[model samples]
Target: MKKPRNKFFQKNKFDQAMTGYLFLLPALVALLVFLIGPIFYAFYISFFRFSFLEPQNAKFIGFSNYIHLFQDKEFLRALWNTSLYTIVVVPIQTAIALFLALIVNNIRGKTFFRVAYYLPTVTSTVAVSVMFTFIFQPDGILNKFLENFGIHGPNYFNSPTFALPAIMMMAIWSSVGQFMIIYLAGLQDIPEEVYEAAELDGARGFRLLWHVTLPLLKRTTFLNVVMSMIGTFQVFDQAYVISGGNGGPLNSTLTVVLDIFRKGFKTMQMGYASAMAFVLFAIILIFTLIQNYFLGREDK
Candidate 1:
C-alpha cells in the first residue's frame, strides 16, 4: 500500500511538471524565434560578404568585414563620437535624475511632481525629437531666450561643432525623467530611521544626504549609470532626426548604431553592418560587465 501511494505521488509530480512546461512553451518559442534566432543568424551572416540587394550572391569572407571596419575612418569616427556621447550624457543624465529624485521624493506634492517630471518618458520619442529640433533651431525659443539674456545661440543642428553637444543635451532631457522615477523608487526603499538617526547625531541637510542617502542609494546609482551608459551608446533617433538622417554636419552626430543602420539598410553592406553591430554589442557588454563588477564589489 505504501509503495503504491509513493508511485502515485511521483506520477502526479511528473504530470505537474509537464503542465508547467506546456504553459511556458509559447513564451519560450517566441524568445527563440525573435531573440535567440536572430542573434545566431546575424552572427552567421557576419562571416560572409552579404548584401540584402544580392542575398543569393553572398560569399564567405571570414574576418575581412572586421578588418575593413578597423581600417574605415568613418567607423573610427563613429566610435569616437559614440564614446564621447556616452561619457557626457550618462553622467549628466544620472546626476540630473538623482537630483530631481532627491528633491521630488522629499516634497509634499511628490506624486504630482513625479508625474510631471516623468511625462517626457511617456511621450513618443519621435515627438520629443521633433520638439527639441525646433527648440534648438537658430530662430527658436532657445535662441530667443538667450538673446533676451544678451547672448546669441549658434545654429545648433547645422554647426558640426555644436550639433553633437545639442543632441546630447536633448538626450539628457528626454532620458532623465525615466531615471528619476527609478531613483525615486530607490529613495523610497531606504529606511527613514537611518535619516532620523543621522539627524539625532546633528547631521542635517547636505551632510545627511551625503553620508546617509547617497551611500544607501549606491545600488540604484549603479543601475542608473549602467542603463544610461547603454542607452547613450545606442542613441540614434535624436541624431537621425536632428541631423536629417544623414548624421550630418560632417558626421558629428553619427553614432555607431546609426552607422550600422546606414551601412545595413541604406548602403546594403549587410556583412559589414553585421560586424559593426557585433562590435557595438561587444562594447555594451564590456561596459556593462565593468559596471557590474566595480559597482557590485563596492556594494559588498
Candidate 2:
C-alpha cells in the first residue's frame, strides 16, 4: 500500500518557513538601505566632483579624484600614519590580549577578573579619550607621576613626538580586554587531553604554552590580528576627540578615516573623500589578504 501523504505537516513547514523570512525582512531591508546602499552610492559618487555644499553642480571627473589622491601629501601622510599605527598596535595588542587571556584562564575568581578586565572595552571610546586627554596633559597625572622620578612629560596632544605614541597606548589599553575575551574562549576550546598528553611528553609551564597552546590557538591569533589591523587602520574617534578634530600636533594622530571626515564634511570635497574611502578600503583588503596568506600558509 502507498504511504499516506502528510499534507498537514507540509503545510505547517511552509508556513514556518514563510514566518521565518517575514521575521528577517525588517533587518534585511534595513541593512540594504543603510549599509549596502551607502557603499554603492559612495562608489558612484567617487567618479564625479560631487560637492555636498553644491550638490546641484556635481560634475563627472572620471578618475581625477583617485589620481589627485596619490599626489595629495596630506592624504599620503594620513595613509602612512594609519599603516604605521596598524603595524605597531596589532602585534602589541594581540600579545597583550593573549597574555591576559593566559593569565585569566589559569586564575581563580575568573569571573571577577574577567569583568574587571573588560571594563575598558565596555566603556565609551569618547569618554575614554576625554579622560585620557586630561591625564596626558603636560601637568596632568601622567606628567606629575613622571616628575616624581625627575622626568618631565611633554604635552601629549601638542607634541608631535608623543602624540601618536599616546594614541597607540590608548588604543591598545582599550582593545586588549575585548580580544582577551576572545582568546579566553579559544583557550577553553583546547582539549584538556591534548595538554595532558603534552605533559606526559615532559611539557610544562612555558613549554606547554610555547608549543601546544600557541600552535593550537593559531586560528584565534589570526582572527585577532586581522581584527586589530582593521580597527587600527580605521581609527578615528580617539584621534578626532583628542586632537579636537583637526589631527593636530603636526598631524601625528591623523588617520585615514579622520582625513576622509575632514575632506567630506569640513571641506565638502565629497567626491575626493569618497575616492579616499575606496582607497582605504582597497588597502585594508590587500592587508587582510596578505595576512590571510601568511597565516594560512603557516597553518599548513
Candidate 3:
C-alpha cells in the first residue's frame, strides 16, 4: 500500500510539471518566433551584401560590411551623437528623478504629485516631439520667455548646435518621470524601522539620507542608471520625429538606432544595417557587463 501511494505521488508531480510546461509553451513559441528568430536571422544576414528586396542575390561578403561601417563617416557621426546623448542624458535624468522621488515621497498629496509628473511617461512620444518643436521655434513660447530676459533664442530644431541640446532637455523631461516612479517604488519598500535605527545613531537629516537612504537604495540606483543608459542608446523616435526623419541639423540628433533605420529602410542596405545593429547590440552588452561587474560586485 505504501509503495502504491509513493508511485501515485510521483505520477501526480510529473503530471503537474507537464501542465506547467504546457502553459508556458505558447509564450516560449512567441518569443522564439518574434524575438529570437529575427535576432539570429539578422546576424546571419549581416555577412551578406544585398538589398533586402533582392535576397536571392545576396553575396557573402564575410566581415566587409562591418569593415566599411567604420569607414562610413555618417555612421561614425551617428555613433558620436548617440554616445554624447547617453553620457549627458543618463546622469542628469537619473539625478533629477531621484530628487523628485525623495521630495514627493515625504510630501502631502504624494498621489497628486506622482500622477502629475508621470503624465509625460504615458504621453505619446511623437506628440511630445511635435509640441516641443513648436515651443523651440525662434518666435515661440521658449524664445518669447528668453526675450523677456533680453536674449534672443535660435531656431532650436533647425540649428545643429542647439538641436541635440533641445532634444536632450525634452528627453530629460519625458524620461525622468518614469525613473521617478521607479525610485518611488524603491523608497516605499524601505522600512520605517531602518530610519528609526538610523536616527538613534546620531545621524541627522542629510547624514541619515547619505548613510541610510542612499546606501539602501543602491540597487534602485543601479537599475535606474542601466535602464536610462539603454534608453538613451536606443533613442530613435524623438530624434527621428524632431529631426524630420532625416536626422538633420548636421546629424547632431542622428542616434545609432536612427542611422540603422535609415540604412535598412531608406537606403535598402539591409546587410550593412544588420551589421550596425549587431555592433550596437555588442556595445550595449559590453556596457551592461561592465556595469554588472562594478555595481553588482557585492551581490551574493
Candidate 4:
C-alpha cells in the first residue's frame, strides 16, 4: 500500500513538470532559434576562413582572422574612430540631456517642450542622415547661416577634418532628447521634501542642483551613459547613409559596425567581419564593466 502511494506522488510530480515546460516551450524555442543560434553561428564562423559568397570554400583557420584584423589598417582606423566617437559623444550627450531635462522640468507646457525636443529622436536615422547630407554640403543651409555671421563653413562630409565632427554634432543633437526624457523621469522621482529640506539648508539654484539633484540622479546618469556608450559604439546607419557605404572621405566617419558591414557584405569576408564584431563586443563589454564598477560603487 505504501509503495502504491509513493508511485502516485511521483506520477503527479512528473505531470506538473511537463505542464511547466509546455508553458515555456514557445519562448524557449524562439530564444534558441533567434538569439542563441546566431551567436553560436557567428562564433563558429569567427574561427574559420569563411565567406557567404562562396559557402563551400570555408576553411578552419583558428585565430588567423582575428590576428589579421589587428594587422589591418582599415580595421585599426575604424576601431580608433569608434572609440573617439564614443568617448566624445557620451559625456556631451549625457550633459546636454541633463541640462535639457532640468530646463523642461521647470518650464510651463512641458508636454509641448517634450514633444518638440524628442522629435529628432523619433525621426528615422536614415532620413536625418540624408537631410543632414544636404545641409552639410558646401552651399547648404549651415554654410549659408555661417556666411551671414562672416564665417565660412567647410563642406562637411567631403573633408576628413570636418566629416567625423559633422556626424558627431548631428548625433549629439538627435540623441539628446531621448536621454532627456529618461532624465526627466528620474527628476520626477525625487521627493519634493528632499528639495524643501535642502532649501531650508540654504541650497538654491545651482547649489541645490549640484548638491541635491545630481547626487540623487546618479542611477539615471549611469543608465544614460551606458546606453549612449553602446549606441555610439554600434553606430552604423547614419555613417553608412552619410558616407554612402564607402567609409570615406578617407574613412573619417567609419565606425566599427560600418566597417563590419563593409567587410562582411561588400568584401565577402564573413569570418573576418565576425572577428571584428567580437572585438567590438569585447571593447564595449570592457567599457560597460568599468562604468558599472565606478558608477555602481558610487551608488552604493
C-alpha TM-scores of all predictions: 0.96, 0.95, 0.96, 0.92
Show pairs that collide, candidate 3. Answer: none
Q: Which lDDT tens digits does candidate 3 get at residues 1-300? A: 899999999999999999999999999999999999999999998999978799899999999999999999999999999999999999999999999999999999999999999999989999999999889998999999999999999999999999999999999998899999999999999999999988888999899989999988999998999999999999998999998789998888898999999999999999999999999998988998998898767775
For model 2, residues 1-300, the per-residue Cα lDDT tens digits are 233357777788999999999999999999999999999999999999999789899999899999999999899999999988988999999999999999999989989989998999999999999889889998899999999999998988899889999999999998799999999999999999999999999999999999999999999998998888889989999999988899987888899999999999999999999999999999889988998999878867
Better by lDDT, candidate 4 or 2: 4
- How many backbone clashes does every candidate have? 0, 0, 0, 0
lDDT of candidate 1 over 134-178, digit per residue (tens): 898999999999998899999999999999998888888877999
Q: In lDDT terms, how accurate is model 1?
A: 0.91
Better of 1 and 4 by TM-score: 1
In model 2, the Cα lDDT at residue 95 comes to 93
Two-way lDDT contest, 1 vs 4, winner: 4
Candidate 4 weakest ten by summed lDDT: 291-300
Candidate 4: where are CA atoms >4 Å away? 1-24
Clashing pairs in 2: none
Q: Give candidate 3's total backbone clashes.
A: 0
Q: How many clashes show up in model 1?
A: 0
Evaluated at residue 78, the lDDT of candidate 4 is 93
Between candidates 3 and 4, the one scoring higher on TM-score is 3
Residue runs of model 3 more than 4 Å from their true location after superposition? 298-300
